[model samples]
Target: MEYKTILVEKRDGIATITLNRPEKLNAVNVDMRLEFLNALDELEIDDNVRVVIVTGAGRAFCAGADISTFESDPARIRRNLVNLKREPRRILSFEKPIIGAVNGVAAGEGSQWLLQFDLMVASEKATIAWPATSLGMACPYGMIRLASEVGRFRAKEALMTSKFLTAEEAYQWGLVSKVVPHEKLMDAAIELADQIKRMPPISIRTIKEAVNRGLEGYEYTYQAAVNQQLSDDFKEGVQA
Candidate 1:
């Protein structure tokens, strides 16, 4: 399959998906989201892909949804929101271990997507935030995942303030497992992926399933409405 906004590369049992919209800071526009969902679907079936890693090509991991493509089409926005909910749920259901190698800033919905991953590693210079409240938007996934990963109070503060969490701060809050130098971010992620690849593939898949089952209990259902606001242009923008 051809992908315009993302790159998928596989080697040594690991499939890496890089958000390729560097000029847009790899933001999750409608097209990118569709392509991402397709790539995830493909990776889930490819037996050679024992593990998956998600990151971005440019300085920022993902700046969030493409505001430029989001305007005033309520029906399209609803469809986009539905896709947002469905795609991440599919990602979380994948049996293979998935990791997010956050190369830079991850904000709004971008930060929410990281919550679906089994593990996360960030560059020392990376920053994370959920600016939905400031943007007059509600972050359904963020509200749930942040509270579960950090704490309810912290999540509330983060969301309400639209604050940025530095790499070190994120580590302290348990958002990322490791923080490496920016230059070594991919190397560190690959090393971690290699380690997982060395483990028994079946056992890794089982562990992932068990962990996801346990985490599923913490997910809040109220955030489902965030998807209701995604634009139609964004939804149709997905590349196949």
Candidate 2:
């Protein structure tokens, strides 16, 4: 499928999805979210792609949702929420291992995406945060399984404080697998993907499935969908 918000490239059993809207710090607009899910759908059935790498095109990994074009109209909100549900569902359910090449800032949904990735390789310049509370909204995606990654208290601090965690701090908190020099971020991610590719394919798929299944979050994700729809604060936050 042709895409405007993301770029897809395949090489040696590895597929990379680059969030392409650099002008907006690769922030996800409605179209971008659709493109992301479409790309994943296309890649899921492609036998040649064993592992996937996700990154952003410019300075930031992704700045989260694009509030400038966010919708608050009731009808549009319903449609948008459907996509919101699909975004995390697709990532969590994808059978192949995904590596996050976090080159810069990853906030809000960006941070949420990183949390779901099988492995996250952050650059020295990268920063991760969940600014939901500050914006008068909740980060259902972040809250779903963040505690499993970083301790429960850390997850609370992250979600409630709306502060940025530097790459090293994120690493120390167990948010990312490793931190590398900015220039070597993709290399580190690709190298890990290659390693996964070398492993038996079925083993890789089964292991990923087992690990993801062990985490419980879909219930919270569903509830968040309902809560966001009825939330005046969420509407105000997104419009701000």
Candidate 3:
């Protein structure tokens, strides 16, 4: 399938998915979300591609959701919400390590995407922000991932205060695995991918599965989705 908002490139054992909408700092809209997932789906099935790198095309990695694309049509909104209920975490359901090559600012949903990645390599200049509360919105996914990564106290503070984390801060918080110069972000991510590629594939997959199994609590994010879906703040956020 042709993708309008993302680029999928395969080479050696690496498949790179580049978010292509730099105009809006790779803010995910309907088309981008669909195409991004489609790209990951293809990579997942390809045995030759043992590792995947997700990055943005331009300066910023991802600025978050495209608020302008929030559906004003009630039917469309309801349909979307219903779909979310079914597939709340349907981004990249792949076994291979998906490395986040964070090149720049990753905010809101961008930060959420960062959390979902198996490993994150952030550029020194990259900034991570979960300012959803400040925007009259809330990121249930980010908060849940935060509690899973860090402790509950830090998650509560970060979410409630709309704390914007620099690359160093993200590393300190154990959000990203590595931090490198802006020019070396992709290089670092690729290096990590290659390093992991040498391990026995089956063993790697098993290890990943075990780690994910321990985080079964993420399933509770579905409840958070429902809570946010029915919230007045979410409505105001979409409208704003």
Candidate 4:
């Protein structure tokens, strides 16, 4: 399917989804969110697609949600938050492996989405952080995912203080699986996807399902918070 904010290309059992709004740092808007969901749905059922990679068009992967949307209509604040809460989980729960190719800075909600990927390849020039607290909003999912990726204390510092970590540091902290030179980010991601394509698809799907089942209770809680964030406080924070 054609998309306005994203470009989807599939080849050799690999599907690459590029966030196309580079001028705005590929920030998530309503259209982008819906298109992304649709693209994922398509990829999930495609028999030829064995792995999926998500990246951005230019320097940044995604800076965050588009603040301009909230500026125009306060109600969009809740809408954006709800989208963030749901989409990442959907990507995480997908049966096929999903890889994150972090080409540059991935901040705010973008950083949160990175945690959902099964594997990650980040450029050496990339940086990741969550600046939600600085914007006067709580990032419950970010906090939980960050802690799970790194450690509790470090995640707290990163989220509360909005500290950005270099790609090397992220890899060292176990946040990203691999760190390569900026130009090699996509190549590394594609290489990994190729390796996954060579593996038995049924085994990969079963392992993913079992792992997800192990976290069934936690997933439900996360989804609930994602839905509950569609509240006045979240809207106010987005408007701010």
Q: Which candidate tops TM-score?
A: 2
What is the TM-score of each predicted model, taking all chains together?
Answer: 0.89, 0.94, 0.90, 0.87
Please give the range of 10 consecutive residues that has the lowest summed lDDT in model 1.
231-240
Roughly what TM-score does model 3 have, to 2 decimal places?
0.90
At residue 112, what lDDT does model 1 achieve? 85
lDDT of 1 by residue, 11-73 (tens): 989999999999988888888989998998899899888889999997999999887876567
Please give, for residues 1-240, the per-residue lDDT of candidate 2 as tens digits: 789989999999999999999999999898888888888889999999999999999899999888888666778876777777777778988988999999899998888888888899999999999987876767777786788888789989888899899999999998789999999988899899999999998998888888877546666765675667567887776666
Better of 2 and 3 by TM-score: 2
Q: What is the C-alpha RMSD of each candidate to the true structure, in Å?
A: 4.7, 1.6, 2.1, 3.1
1 against 2, candidate with superior lDDT: 2
lDDT string for model 3 (101-213, tens) is 99999987778887778899999999988887875656756767778888999998898898888999999999899899899888899899999988998988887666655
- Structure candidate 2, residue pairs in collision: none
| Candidate 2, lDDT over the whole model | 0.86
Locate the minimum summed-lDDT window of 10 residues in model 2.
Answer: 214-223
Total residue pair clashes for candidate 2: 0
Name the regions of candidate 3 deviating beyond 4 angstroms: 73-75, 82-88, 214-220, 227-230, 238-240
lDDT of 1: 0.82
